[model samples]
Structures are given as structure tokens and as C-alpha cells.
Target: MSSQETEVLVVGAGQAGVAMSQHLTERGIPHLVLERDRIAERWRTGRWDSLVANGPAWHDRFPGLEFDDVEPNAFAPKERVADYFEAYAKKYNAPIRTGVEVTSVRRKDGESGFRVETSDGTVNARYVVAATGPFQKPVIPAVVPDTQGLAQIHSSAYHNPQQLPDGAVLVVGAGSSGVQIAEELQRSGRQVFLSVGPHDRPPRQYRGKDFCWWLGVLGKWEMAAPPKGAEHVTIAVSGANGGHTVDFRALAAAGITLVGRTNSFNNGTMHFASDLGRNIAAGDANYLSVLDEADLYIARNGLDFPEEPEARVLGDNPACVTKPLLELDLGAAGVTSIVWATGFAVDYSWLQVDDAIDAEGRPRHQRGVSTEPGIYFLGLPWQSRRGSSFIWGVWHDAGYVADQITIQRGYAAHVADVPLRQAATSAQSHTELSERIAVTQGA
Candidate 1:
């Protein structure tokens, strides 16, 4: 096997990975980004055909590059997002090795770095950044029994309404994915049965502004955790068509059947928990909590904004909160397809360093810093803040990792951001950015 060495090693070529590579490159860090597939592989293969980014195009962009000539508020579809990464990588000439999947990450023998084993060969680096964002593996519940014949697919595999078998679809998990897919199927004239669960149902827009705007104004993006003893609730608002909430109430209003959480499937009957109304109410309540935070922020700032109508709090025609359907006969309901949008599971099984993971096998890190030096993580949900896993947020954490990697590599400064002076005369002052970066990397 071939052996190579670099200053830093980045695994995965998604949004976070690419961003991390760019930042490290700028700082003159010698790094190699190993991607399991093409750039933005998950965006290319794991999302639906009609799936648009949950946020606007402008908000999804990386640090240096804005969507040139593209509408800022436009909803970027999967391919658009993928192409942006490809362009960004090429623009920066990122040191990426596509189709090279990393198999193991272990401490180098008698060294203070990591040895990365990939399909092609091995690499040694002073620092390692695991930038594989969230949505690593689709998590289908164990209770979802093996369907006898119904075609079942995870939300990641779902492409469009036409891809499913021509029959009513049962979409388990009422999160953004579940709600979006159900809405798509419903619009395609297919009956959709959505399973309700605990979720946040923040309005797409509030006070004539995008919901995220309020979050930013309230400094919620920098929030890494909730108050002690308070539950950490994941926000599930959808941003289709600029900003639209795809909650249970929205689905019910769209004629999608709202069912309770699936408990078990036995003898052709799938039992459900009787918590539909409670779940919807919980979502509304969580949304209210967010609004409350925003409200406090507004009062603290003393900003006067018009309030939206009470009915518009959820939707134009919010679905009346209904009782849970405790049981559903799959055959009788004509549910021919089941799409589990239960979200993804985080896994770091390839990490071989002791103490790298906690008892739960999750990365044992604080703000991306691992217990083991030189090993860091990026793109984890709430890794640093509530927005850590989001496109708008991953770049922040990536920049931090880049600085750490640079410092760890014994660069000229804490980071490779030092200006590279070309031995110019004393009269020459204020070196240009291009020259500085060029000479810095060359050094």
C-alpha cells in the first residue's frame, strides 16, 4: 500500500468537509481531504429529487463564496447545492481525493498524530478532522416490522412521488423529511398517512421575516445548549418556497391522514401510540417557546414589529389537532409503501483511538475538540451551538478546526494566516492578500 503524509487529514467531502479544507488551505495548512465519493455525495445521492434546501441559497453558502448571480432567497435544490461545492472545491483547488473511503482512524505508532486507512492506501497526518455532517445513516425504528410485501424506503432514498409504488403511502416520523415527502405525495394525488411524533413546529415566517432571522436576532444560533434540566428539542421547521412550515398541522390541512407514532407491527396490524393531539400540541408549544425567546429578545432590544394574526400562527389553514389513530390496518388502509423519515444515526465506528468515544460510542469531544489530541469532529448536531449541524453553521466550526490544525502543525503562528513577506524593500508596505496567501502557502 502507498503511504503518504500531510499536516491535516479531513474525512468526508460534504459541506463541512469542503469548508474545512478551504479554511485549512487558506491558512497554509498542508492537508488532504479524503472523500468516500464525489463532492457532496450525500446531497447528490441521499435526497429527494424535489428536495430543496431547508434554507435559502444565500444562507447555505460557505464563508468566502456567495451564490454568484443566483437569487439569494431562491430555494436551492440538491443538485444546485452539490454543484456549489464542486465549484467551490475547484475554485480553491482543494486537495481532495474522491472515491477514497476511509476505513479506519487510529493513532500513529509512537507518534502524536493519526494514521488513516483508506480503500486506496494509508495517510499519516498531524491532525484529523471528521467533517462528515449529520445524516450519516438513516435510522428506521426496530418497531417497523419487516413489511411482507409493501415497498419501504428511507427518506434518504426517496426521490419523488413517481418513484413509489402506485398506492397510498405511510410516512413514519413527522419531522421535516416526513412532512415534506408526505406533502409531495399528497400533491401528486397520492394519499399520505403521516405518523405524528414529538417535534418543533416553528412557523416558517414570523413578524414578516424568516423564522431564522428571528433566531439570528435572538442569538439563538450561538446557543450550544438549552438551560440545565430543560430538554434539548430539535427544530423541525421546513423552508420550502422561501419559508413554509411543514408540520403535522400543515400536513393534516393538506388532507394527509395524521396517525399516531408506530409502536409495533404484528399480524398485519401496526399498533400506534395514542399521542397525535399531544404531539401536535407539543410541537406548537415548542414553537411557542422559540417565539418566547424571540419575544424576549425583541423586548430587550426595544424593537417594535407588527404581530401576525392568531390563525396565521401555524398556517393559513392549520389542521385541527386530532385524536390519535391507535391502530391502522396496513392492508385495509391500502398502504402500499412505507417511507421511514425517522432521521439519521450518528456513528464513529471507524475511529480506533481509545477514549475517542464515550460509552455510547459517540465522539467524546467538546466543541469539536476530542479527548485525544489532534483528533477533532465537525458537522455534529449542536457540536458547538444549535446551528452546528446546519449549512449556515458548519463553516464556523470548520474554521475553528482549521486554526487548531494549523497551530498543532507548528506553523509560523497559531494559524498559517501569517502574511508571507517576499523580502520586499522597507519602502513597500501593506502586502496584498493574494501575494500574502501565495507566499504563505509556498512557505
Candidate 2:
């Protein structure tokens, strides 16, 4: 087995991984990026054909590249964005080893470094950055009762309406993915039923102004300054994780029957929340209200508006009707295709670090540094700022982590002969000390 070495080893070659690699390379850090497949495989294979970014094209660009000659708010197709990433990698001359899958990463016994075992060979590194994004795993609800004779698919597997079975399609989960899939299915002349969940709504254009305008003005995409000591602020509403602003009202207006939360399925009947309309209406109201507040904030901040005669409060908005959660008889409704657009989960089984992750399976790190000394995470939702996981938000986190890694590697070089067991023990003691200080400060 051939053995190779680098200062840092970055896993994955998506937007986040590529961005991190770029930063590391620019800093003159000797690092190697290992990717399990070709670059941008998710965008090429996982996304639907008609799928465009929910946000603007300007927001989607990496650190140094522009999308097209068009305005920033233009919506670039998925393939175009993938092409941008590929170009970014070539431009930077990033040291990426493609088609190399990392099997395990364990601490080297006699050295303060890691032994990364891959299908091709092994790599010894001082630090490892896991840039594998959150969307690695697709989450399908366990509560969804299995049907005897129905085709079921997760949103990841769904490409277009043509893949759906010829019958009424019941889409579970009304998040952005669910709503988009449901809308597409409905447009295809399929009898589509959408299950309403906790979601937000926004018009395609808010008072003739693009929604991205407000987001930019409000500093929603700005990297938040890290909190002092251990004090951290919780996340407020933003574009990335809060919910998607889909034209649900338009979908409802178009004759799509909105259902409630999926409770269970029995005898081919899907049960849903009785107050489905109420939930949808409430969600719409809250989102509009937030946008209204955002508009006010923008005006107060003396920002120029794209739309003249800025939008005013419509009026006292009525709470949407919520019918009692009910069940849909799938067999009676002739439901053939069930698309579970529920959401995604993060899976790190391939990652060998166990102590650094939390109960929710998220990396237990302040910003990106894990409890372990040399392991780090990037591309997590709200990882640093409101939009850390967003295309625009990732650069700051990537740069910060890269700098920290470089600094730490400098310190490690002076003590490279330290034994692994001693280093692990010291790391644990430091973590404990930090926790104690945090608790003391809180008290």
C-alpha cells in the first residue's frame, strides 16, 4: 500500500469542499482534497431537470466567480452552476484526488496525526476537514405506513413528473422540496395532493421587488461575528432554513388540494392533520408579516427599493382555515405514486470520528472545530451565520476554518513528536476546561 502525506486532508468535492480547498491552497497550505466521485455529482444526478435555485444567481456564485453577464437576481439553471464549480476547481489548481473514497480515519498511534485509509491507499495528515454536506442522507419518515401495492420514492430519487406513476400522487411534507415537487406534479395534469406542514410563504415578487433584494439589504447573508467566550445567539428567521417561500397560494388557487400533516396510512388511506388549511393560512400570514417587517427595516436603513410605492400592510390578515386532521384513503383516492418530499438528514457513518458528534448527529463544534483537535466540519445549516450553509455563506466559514487549521498546524509542527495518546488526553482536558469556563461564566 502506497503511503502519502499532507498537512491537511479535506473530504468531499462539492461546493463547500472545493471552496475550502481553494482557501487552503491560496494560503500556501500543503493539503490534499479527497473526493469520493467526480465533482458536482449531486447537482448532476440528484436534482430535477426544471429545478432552479430558489435564490438568485448572484447569491449562488463561489468566492471568486460570477455566474453570467445577466443581473445578480437571474436564476441560473442547475447545470450552469455545476459548470461554474468545475471551472472554479480548474482555475485554482486545487489538489483534489478524485474517485478516491475514504474508508476510515483513525488517529495514528505514535504521532499526533491521522491515518486516512482509502480504497486507493492511505494518507497521513495532521488535520482532516469533513466538507461532506448535510444533504448526504435523505430522510423518509418512519411513521409513513407502508402500502401493499404502491410505488414510493423519496424526493432525491424523483427527477420529473414523468417518473411518477400515472395516478393521484400524494406528496408528504410541505417544505420547499415537497411544495416544488407537488407543484410540478400538479402542472403535469396529475391529481396531486400536498400535505401541509410548518412552512412559510412568499410571493414570486413582493410588491414588484425581488425577494433576494430584501434578504441582501437585511444582512441575512452576512457572516455573523462569533460570540464572545461561550455565549451564542440562536438563529432567527432567514432564507435558508426557516422555510421556503413558494407560491402556495397560487398552487391553492390553481386547484391543488392542500392536505394536513400525514398522521399514518392504513388500508391505503393516508391520515392527515384536520387543520390543514389553518396551518397553511397561518404559515402564509407569518411569512408575509416577516417580509413586511423586513421591508420596514430596509426602509429604515435607507435602502433603495426596486419597486416604487413600497408595499404597505395589506390589512388584518385572517387566519387560514385548518380543517381537523383527516385521513386520505389512498386506495379510494386512487393514489399510485407517493413522493416523500419530507426532508434530508445528515449521516456520518463513513466518518470515523465518534466522540466529536452530538446526539442529533451534528458535529459538536463551536464554529467548525470539533471536540477532537484536528477534525472540523463545514457546510452545516446556520453553522456560523444565518446563511452559513448557503452558497454565499459558505466562503466565510471555509476561510475562517482554513486559517485556524493553518495556525494550528504551525503549532503542531513544533510538537510533532508528541504521542497520540498524550495529545488526545490534552485535547480532552482543554475541552473540559472550556466547558467549565463556559458554565462558570453562565452562572
Among the numbered candidates, top lDDT falls to 1
Clashing pairs in 1: none
**What would you estimate as the lDDT of candidate 1?**
0.77
Q: Candidate 2 on 1-443: residue-level lDDT in tens?
A: 37998878999988888889998877666789888888877887787777666667766677678876535766666677778888899999988888999998888886677999998899999899989887888878776455367888898899999987789998887766777778778888998888776654544456445556555666655646533531222211223222234655556666677777788766666777676666656666655665776778857878665653433333332232333337777778788988887667787776676667777786788778889889999887767886786687777789878767755644453475755344333233444434533543454
Taken over the whole model, the C-alpha lDDT of each candidate is 0.77, 0.71
Kindly provide the TM-score of model 2 when superposed on the true structure, using C-alpha atoms.
0.83
Q: How many pairs collide in each candidate, listed in order?
A: 0, 12
Please list the Cα RMSD from the true structure of every candidate, rounded to 1 decimal place.
5.6, 7.2
Q: Which portions of model 2 miss their true places by more than 4 Å? A: 69-71, 145-147, 202-204, 207-209, 222-245, 301-325, 416-443
For 134-210, candidate 1 gives per-residue lDDT tens digits of: 68878887765564788888999999998998889999887777888888899999988888777777767666666
Give residue 154's error in model 1 in angstroms.
Answer: 0.9
